[model samples]
Target chain A: MSEIACVECGAEIRLDEDVIQNEILPCPDCGVELEVMSLDPVQLALAPEVEEDWGE
Target chain B: MTRVAMVITRVRAEEKMLLEVFRQRGTDPELIRDEELVINPSVIDPRWDEFDIVLQRSLSTSRGLYLLELFDAWGVPTVNSLRTASICSDKFKTSLALAKAGVPQPEVRIAFTPQSALEAVTELGYPAVLKPMIGSWGRLLAKVSDADAAEAVLEHRQTLGNYPYHVHFVQSYVEKPRGRDIRAFVVAGETICAIYRSSSHWVTNTARGASVEQCPVTAELQDLCRRASEAVGGGVLAMDVFETEGGFVLNEINHTMEFRNSIEPTGVDIAGRIVDYALALAAQLERGEGE
Candidate 1:
């Protein structure tokens, strides 16, 4: 597992090796949803909010 | 080996489960991010031809429909065909298809302007539902109990500035038993499993915090699901059904369905079933026996 600081609260967030791009994870401390933007260098960003057209 | 491509906007739980299922079945499926995908209609991308079949799983209905159309034009097989996507993406189109196929569904009326929409809602009677022409997850669904609520909703939608919002699609709200409705999963012309999404709220979509439990697939349900699937050009579909004193009526059909919350309750491997269906479709296409 690789550890990365939460973009919101700077809390340590451990990511599994199998995490895929665009996967959403919740911040353990602040409860904000984070998106794995990239996996190579472990980039993270706030997840996109639900849009009107975003649904199955 | 069948080269399968799963198109998506974000890697949601459903997509992850599907990818794992594909791997477990010994096929490393390609994940095509629809947001980053660029297609040159003038020049064919060789990468597109590499996949034997594509699974249309994009979260955006418009994106999924357009991509399905493009894939169809390229002679690439897709799990849910372009015909299905087009019909299911628009509630009005879906209602027409279902009505023509003699599928039992809620009474619906369509109007262009807010004034006419109020008339349509009035015709459907008070407590009618106002829905966007193209939407899912039960978003923007309003159950107008009276003329006051109807006017407010219609006015709000008119000001939203979106054409779809302006074009009103109204339906008679069916009262459910125990505040629950059935969501049946159909794969490749078969009703694989079903679940009851129960909630105190009128919109009982699981996305809206509805609790779920396995719903037994009765013969009536199976028949209705099969007919509904056929009406919308079948593939992998989720049909929402409403139970009333008369019987069950289809609410809507989702072309790209979400099934993550349904697996445990139904005791059915929905992702696995979908992957198997895609592989079978690939094999059929490979043998030159598919459309």
Candidate 2:
């Protein structure tokens, strides 16, 4: 399993062994939504805010 | 069980709805991510042929189209056929098809250059609309109220310097009741239901916060929707219409449409109807109806 240091509360986050890019996770301590922006060397960033959209 | 494969990029509300319906119906449907899909000519995956049908639900227009094309080439019956997706994806082709089928739609003109586009707008009269030839969610749509606005929009398109941008898609704006437009969902040659999308703004796309309400599915609307579907090669479609003082004018048809809000308003099982349609197509394919 891969580990990530949460950018929010610095909590250690263990990603799924087969975690794919763009998989979203929440910070354990602060609960900030994190998106796996990159896979190699595993970088996480704040998930982009998704606006509530009505049916198109 | 009707074996099905759904091509999707993201699991949005619509996908979730369809997946639930499929599960309830005892379908062991496979969810294929669009990002990981590719056309491998050298070693074609024979596994794709196992499914009776494939459903295209990619949020991106280009990806949906290309994936549908590949599915078609593999002899897999797709929910909305490749022909329907391509024609509806391009606004100009859609207008031609609808016009040829005698479906009343907004007057649209295609100009290769900014100069001709401006001239076409002038001929259409003031307050004309300009839109991108290929897009959805009402993006890149400009309401050119006058010559100045038209020139500015044209100049901006020119500045973009892209080939597709140069081909200006100018349209005549229809006068509808303030903040109201009709969106009717069609599935497999049936006009399921019609919803009035209302908002305070000119564009009444639901994605733009337009509220939706049930509109009576009158015979006239049913007939019009059927004709519109046939005009665009017939499949699952959503028709954007304008109820004007004159009458109902068809605006555009969406192949892979979004209809989360239409469910409550229409009281029709939109996802169920779509799955049923796909199963029917799969049956036909199994019977060798169309290769």
Best model number under DockQ: 1
Which residue runs does candidate 1 get wrong by more than 4 Å? none
Please give, as one word, the docking class of candidate 1: high
Error of 1 at B265 (Å): 0.9
Candidate maximizing lDDT: 1
Per-residue lDDT tens digits for candidate 1, residues B28-120, read 988889999777877667888888999988988878888888898888899899999899999999999999999999999999999999999
Candidates in order, TM-scores: namely 0.97, 0.85
Give the interface RMSD of candidate 1.
0.9
As a TM-score, model 1 comes out at 0.97
Alpha carbon lDDT of residue B187, candidate 1? 93
Which tens-of-lDDT digit does each residue in A1-56 have in candidate 2? 98889988889999877465555677878989887778898998886664212112
Clashing pairs in 1: none
- What value does the interface RMSD of model 2 take? 6.3
lDDT of each: 0.91, 0.83
